[model samples]
Target: MKRTNCKIAFNDKLLMLFAIPLLSFIIPIVFFGCRLNRQPYFNVARFFSTFIIIVLLWMVNRYILIWCRKRYPRFSDVRKRLLIQISTMLLVTLLGNNLLHYILTETIFTENPVSVFDTDHLITSNAAAMFCLIMIIGIYESIYFMHELRSSVQETENLKRENLAAQLNALRTQVNPHFLFNNLNTLISLIPENPDHAVDFVQQLSKVYRHILEVKDEKSIPLKDELDVLHAYTFLMKTRFDKNLEVNVDVPAEKLQKRIVPLSLQILMENAIKHNIVSSDKPLQINVFTDNGSLVVSNNLQMKKQVNESTGIGLNNIRNRYKMLSDAPVKVTESETNFTVSIPLIEQ
Candidate 1:
């Protein structure tokens, strides 16, 4: 079984509770004899005396820690807990040693035994050394706990951010279906008069929708992939407008190999079409070109007077998605005659 499974058996409390006292008693008894003059049976008596002291000390330590935890439930501040633990350990050790010494010296150790209290100087010096050892252990435990707590908090925050991003992406994906539906309705209206054009239009429409579905699982797609979708979309528009729709693409093939947020170009194209008019007399001349490491999509502004349902969500969604990846802002240039959108190209 795993070490974590063993820890769980004790409800996550430290397993040192059993081992510490046993080791503490064994070490002192083996090293230090009961009688300083080295009499017979000194080792045996010392072993039993040390064992009793170890058991009592362990009980006192556990009780004190449990009491402190219960009293101050929100006492999670590492520094504060360290101070309390250090203070309690010193107090307990001093009291325990003195109580053990008094009991053994007065009752059990009436014959040849170890000295309970040496003198004024020795008692003070021994107490200081014991206090220092306890404080060091407490500080180490506090630092360890503090580091673990910080890591746990950071992991929780990262998970939350990921969940929020996934929800936002799902909402953005929904916009593509609405755009496809509108374009399909327009193609249906023109199918009777121009059957051949409509057939070509349906083929281009299929390519565009297929691209969207293929890239849906991707957070970002190569610039080349996005341009392929854009080309398909423009082909459908050409089928609808014939020679009247003038579309130009001047992006570098090298730069097109880089990555960009999926459907970014398509959304901008849809926005341009939705807000402007396309006709023979004043034909929609839309341009896609790169300038200064950025892709620029610009078109002549011929605004439609008729207002449509404005969710005001598409541009904001695109902006938000880009923000998650980089610091570069989506630049929008608007005038009486033209509307241009400049999007930064991201390295894969």
Candidate 2:
């Protein structure tokens, strides 16, 4: 990266040297109708001497600014870095003007020393040169900043898309046959003892799967739609834990129209159960409520001593999905006795 930046800086210097001098010569000949067309040698020598000095000043200013930016990056330390930049530019402009004035008076236009060194002539020439040179540097920096901004925006968008795809893949894994197999075994056990409840279980299971499939293309869904999906998921969990797992949702009717990342509640609930001991002796109680335009999911912590290994994909998926869907974060609060997550309820 350092080597590439050095190469770019070298190319920019070359481009400025060639382009600025060529334009300087052409503008007078084409637009101003200066007799530079008749006295090509004098005109060429004058412009060439002046541009050579300006280019040197530009190269020095560029190097100094690059060093300042590296030491105090604009994004991290904007005020200090900009102060250093302006000071450096002024110093370079002063030195460059003095150098140009000396060259014109001593060598290039020696026949007119009085005009070159006269107070008014010196002030006008120095001011014009400083303004033009600084403008060149300013334009270059502006273009570079614009390019960087565009690249940063594009990279952020790409990362958002990639994370969204990862969330989808994780959701797909959750809905795959391995997950179905466990529930299938539970259903098999229930069918022989309670045939009617097994039918209801199968129906809810189908609804849960359908909801997952339907939300694949959606970034956010109404809270009520998510609640319906959560109800279907709760039915499946109830089959396994029965009285050991209790879930209560207490959201008001007015908040139902608010939006959230789909399946976020289900993911949080599952995360709570996966890490907790759910048994008749120590039941896991999960509560879903709304507070200050936020959906809060809290569960009593009864951490299991032994359980199946956890992959932690669900919570991460929910967090990543929330990041893409809204600027508000999925806030988590944990303690020795409870784990809570608050998701910002987006207005539809």
Tell me the spans in candidate 2 whose CA falls farther than 4 Å from its real position. Answer: 1-167, 306-312
The sequence of per-residue lDDT tens digits that candidate 2 reaches over residues 219-248 is: 889999999989998999989889989999
Instruction: List the lowest-lDDT window of 10 residues for candidate 2.
Output: 1-10
C-alpha lDDT of residue 11 in model 2: 39
What are the per-residue Cα lDDT tens digits for candidate 1 across 178-246?
Answer: 766766776887789878878877888788768766776665789998898889988877766767677
Query: Which one is best on lDDT?
Result: 2
Query: What lDDT score is found at residue 93 in candidate 2?
Result: 78
Residue 257, candidate 1: Cα error in Å is 0.9
List TM-scores for all candidates, in order: 0.48, 0.61
Superposed Cα deviation of residue 152, candidate 1 (Å): 16
Candidate 1's C-alpha runs over 4 A off are: 1-198, 311-313
User: In model 1, what lDDT does residue 30 have?
Assistant: 45
Model 1 clashing-pair count: 0
